[model samples]
Target chain A: MTAVPNGHDGLITARGLYLSFGAIPALVDVDIDLWPGEVLAVVGESGSGKTTLLNVLSGRVAPDAGAVLYTDPEGEQHDVHTMPAPALRTLHRSDWGFVHQDPKQNLRMNVSAGGNVGERLMARGARHYGTIRAEAIDWLTQVEIDADRVDDLPRTFSGGMLQRLQIARTLVTHPRLVFMDEPTGGLDVSVQARLLDLIRTLVARLGIAAVLVTHDIAVARLLAHRIAVMQRGRVVETGLTDQVLDDPQHAYTQLLVSSVLQV
Target chain B: MIRTEGLAKTFTLHLRGGMQLPVFSGIDLTVHSGECVVLSGPSGAGKSTLMRSLYGNYRAGAGHIWIRHHGGMVDIAASEPRIVLAVRRETLVYVSQFLRVVPRVSTLDIVADEPITRGIAPDEARDMAGSLLLRLNIPRRMHGIPPATFSGGEQQRVNVARGFIAAHPILLLDEPTASLDAENRSVVVGMIQEAKARGTAVVAICHDADVRAAIADRLYPLSPAREAA
Candidate 1:
């Protein structure tokens, strides 16, 4: 299937993606695409295969059928699942980033916050220590963390600070695409708002394409330009975030949206 | 500019056991730069539905809506969500009959919000908001206060101010002067003409014949019709 229009720049394209785990289908004939500088949110209830789809699309999980194709900013196409392990690892450390749902799962708890942010740059071959440190401090400040805490261990930071530190580390390499799984999950309301705001601002400022996996409709509405509603291993509906959420066409989507508690 | 061919819309009432309601069909409407086209007909004519569909508020059941965005023709009916958002930001804008905003947001912020989001300086955006409020006859004293407690006419003026602040290429006004008095209605009519003079294509639904005569470049009539049995 065709992705975005000709005038638009392409980022990622997936076709007929099917996967299973011991007879439990995780993705069934899934087809998705992404354009640069756009955020596409995947939303559904727990156990809907939202996370599985994200993992497969990011090349962390192998699909039983179909392929995930990514076009770099240099105008080169790379098949995500077919690349060599070192090639894929290099791609992950450089051109792509994946943000786990839990901060602890993403960060080095014992490492200094500065080191956490600088390590990605080091992997990308930023040779100058002073420059890496300066960039780390800049990223910490960008995520609203104080520069004085650059050397503090991440385990000592609050939930919000830990999440922000993880984000800073993920974004330090100037990755062209990021796959985030509930970046604001398991946080206080105010902290979630602030972190989501930072993610929104950074994503917009950097023009990074993203596939965000979230169950929160409000979060999707705030951060995503488009949305894909997953239900039991299939994307039941996909369209503009406002259009799909506002006027859901699928029956399952209608029920899912209506079930949200109104604040 | 905006153009549509064979555009149609239908609503399926889920609560009514899936009964389908066809709103309109076979409509060919076009509005060019420096022009205003008004949708004219009776109450059940689907004028509001047509306007909302054109603004990408409702998904069209059939046909194409070709809108000029970023110097290209974008069919909003079929384009992806990112493309639609770009169109709304740069080309298409809509001012509904009512003002819907966050609670306790001052009228000045409501009016200034558009340009500020478009990267205009906050102070300059506020200044533009003040001038537009004053031009709409909304007193400067009321700018800092929320429009929630204001009368319907005043609120409509705030929406008008917000809609015009960004100078988008196309505009859709739905019942802009329904609650306005004779004098303020003329003020809005004048503002609309000014926008048209600035090469803004407009599609509006105004019941007032005088207002229609004053600003309408053409009338696209839509009346309810029976479907084939």
Candidate 2:
């Protein structure tokens, strides 16, 4: 297991972040930090601005106010909101991973499974075909696919397997930070269980810092070290997973907990 | 009530070629309706092995496990496989610490499978399973995805949902709270209490003192076998 951070390192810090679209606010005065080697889940109902916060923090959407800073491995702080486009793109390609909700959206449909994974490595300047293929196969096996199927097209794989392949492709590059938006969405219960297990193992083994956005409190409780609950584009509560979920202090959080759908 | 007499189990070490490793023997226990019985022991003791034997996952070396089924006592130890499966489906439920994965199956369907098989409408079963997953903290977005990539805590919740949704007459839980956080643990305690109130018989192994204190009616201790020491 990778050495977990001692709750000191701030990999990404956002201060007084504010954003709006066409006069309506999508995020309002939000501040948070992404720590190294920890999973942080941002949870809330749809249109509560959880996704907007993720996009802003990930530099996909620029905020109108506040500053978002990212600390590189060398401890140099870069202003994410104002960073040059090329440098920001480079940062995402080499140091970060993004997993979309749909596997088809995240994976390259035309590429072979191995090619999908190898492409990530190739972007970082891996030139040797034999070495890249070997690494890709190794990663495929790690995601629970047969090594022999490395040459097969992802279109032939099941939805669950496709998601696994996408994960392998994203993580094979050893990205330091991963942003996931409903990574387990669109799968059935049985497949989701196994897939969740796999994702947990990979996240821990890689020591990847993650910001996972989900509407499910259970997903937050399971995967996140800390949770930040958002409502109407503002954070209602933030704390360790157990504390926030078990003894929620905010009225909104309390309602969310008690309102958990029952069978 | 479900009762056992002289329940014993032994494993022949396949690699060691016929050497018998006896787990436990001469065990006597009874679990009555609305009661929770907890098995307590050290790591090497046969608590889990014995629990599995009672659930018919392992063949007991010697004993009679009488389970109340259809207004009669069925000897699970000597019953045919068909009878055992029927009892498992209709009367007994087992929740293990580690989830057994059914490849490419989503988390919702896994939890809903038992209830659906028991004649619940598919939509109702899915809804119930969805609610259970929500209660267990599984995300709604994950309702349709396969479970193979879920974290340990998530997978355990799926397992718990599957076992509880069955609402069988008897429950066998092995470390059901092993991977859960304090919040989810309390949820599990509530589920257990609800099951007991419905007159379900429960046998469980829990090392967490808080959970044990919350649900156990009595403690059954198991010790490692010592050959005539």
Best by TM-score: 1
Give Cα-based local distance difference scores for all models.
0.88, 0.86
TM-score of chain B of 2: 0.97
Per-residue CA lDDT of model 1 for B1-229, tens digit only, reads 8899999988765645666778899889989999999999999889998988887878889999999988899998887677788899988999999886645568998788778778888899999999999999999899999898999999998898889887898999998898999999999999899999999999999999999999999999999856534
Clashes of each: 0, 38
- Give a tens-digit lDDT track for model 1, residues A1-263: 24543323578888889988888998998889888888999999999999999999889999999998888768887889998889889989998998988889878888999999999999998989999999999999999899999999997899989989999999999899999999888998878867876887788778888999999988998889889999989998998887787667777877877888976
Model 2 chain A poorest 10 in a row by lDDT: A1-10
Ten contiguous residues with the weakest lDDT in model 2 chain B:
B11-20
Report the lDDT tens digits of candidate 2 across residue range A153-258: 9989998899899899889989999999988888887788688878876896688999999988877777777788999889988766655675455667777877
Residue-by-residue lDDT tens digits, candidate 2, B36-130: 99999998799998888888776678989999998899998887543676798799999998876546668898888788767788899999999
DockQ of each: 0.31, 0.03
* TM-score of each candidate structure, all chains considered together: 0.84, 0.55
Model 1's CAPRI class is: acceptable
